[model samples]
Target: MVNLWTSSEHALSYLAIADAIPHRTEGEGVLLNQVPKTVRRILDLGTGNGRLLSLLKIDRPQAECIGLDFSPTMLAAAQEQFMGDDSVHVQVHDLDQPLPDLGQFDAVVSSFAIHHLAHERKRSLYAEIFACLAPGGVFCNLEHVASPTERLHQQFREAMGIGDRPDDPSNKLLDVETQLQWLRAIGFEDVDCYWKWLELALLIGRKPTV
Candidate 1:
């Protein structure tokens, strides 16, 4: 219930350790592989500091990218990340609310975000993501998911070297299976947990071309 993302300190702390998260790049690589190079547009939800969007632009240089986040600190950092680049735009938007009318996208992606939302909102957001995708488009979410048991969760904490530290109060972690089911019920095809490393997992789904 305590969303500290709005605080500058919380945002900075996350940015400082963002790259150090174990196996994160591997999940990111898997996400990149799911999206096609020919995608005309991309939407990055909760695009903190635009990290994922930057990676996406590596192979999708011509793609028009939009990164959305509500935190002022995050928005500034994202803006700085894409400065002098007209193709990438970072804007203010809260993931807890309905996504703005940004038209449709060929690829919708997120990383290490979305879990902060309440369970009901998470499901609704997945539905909204489904609505925003173009036919044949894909949704790739590299997320922090819940473990099946508390012991596994504790092991994950220890693996992350944070066993002694308190859990992030902001994380409302949900299991991957429920999310995959939501995607399938929302009419996505080929829905599955494409990649995973302990609590980290990549959930991928595609819209039908027809």
Candidate 2:
């Protein structure tokens, strides 16, 4: 319930160590690979600093991208990331609310975000995502998921060298299986966790072409 992302200090602290999270790029790579190179329009949810959007643009340079985040600090950073790119638009949006009418997208992506939402909001957001996608479109979320046991959770904290630090109160992680099932129930086809490393996982699903 407590999200510190709006605080500049919290946002900056996260950016300071954003790249140091182990195996993060590997999950990102898998996400990038899953999205088709021919997608013309993409939407990035909770797009902090536009890192994942930047990666997505690498291969799909012609794709028009919209990156959404609520934090001013993150919005500024994301704007800076795509300053001169007319094809990329970064805007403010809170994940707790229903999505605005942004039209359909060929692909919808998120990374290391969304877990901040409460569980109910998370499920609703997944349904919203389904509605926003074009037929045959893809939705990929590279997320921080919950561990099965307290022992495993502690091990994950130790693995990330965050055992000494307090757990992020903003995080509302759900297990990967539950999320995959939610996606499936929302009418997504081929829903699955495409890649994983401890608590880091990539959940992907595609709208049926018909």
- Candidate 1 yields a Cα-based lDDT of 0.94
Residue 200 in candidate 2, Cα distance off native in Å: 0.4
**For all the candidates, what are their Cα RMSDs to the real structure?**
0.6, 0.6
lDDT of 2: 0.95
Question: How good is model 2 by TM-score?
Answer: 0.99
What is the Cα root-mean-square deviation between model 1 and the actual structure? 0.6
- Per-residue lDDT for 1-210 in model 2, tens only? 798899999999999999999999899889989999999999999999999999999999999999999999999999998999999999899999999999999999999889999999999999999999999999999999999999999999999989989899999999999999999999999999999988999999999999
lDDT of 1 by residue, 70-125 (tens): 99999999999999999998889989999999999999999988999999999999
Q: Go through the candidates in order and give each one's C-alpha lDDT.
A: 0.94, 0.95
* Model 1 CA lDDT for position 39: 96
Q: What TM-score goes with each of the models? A: 0.99, 0.99
Off by over 4 Å in 1: none
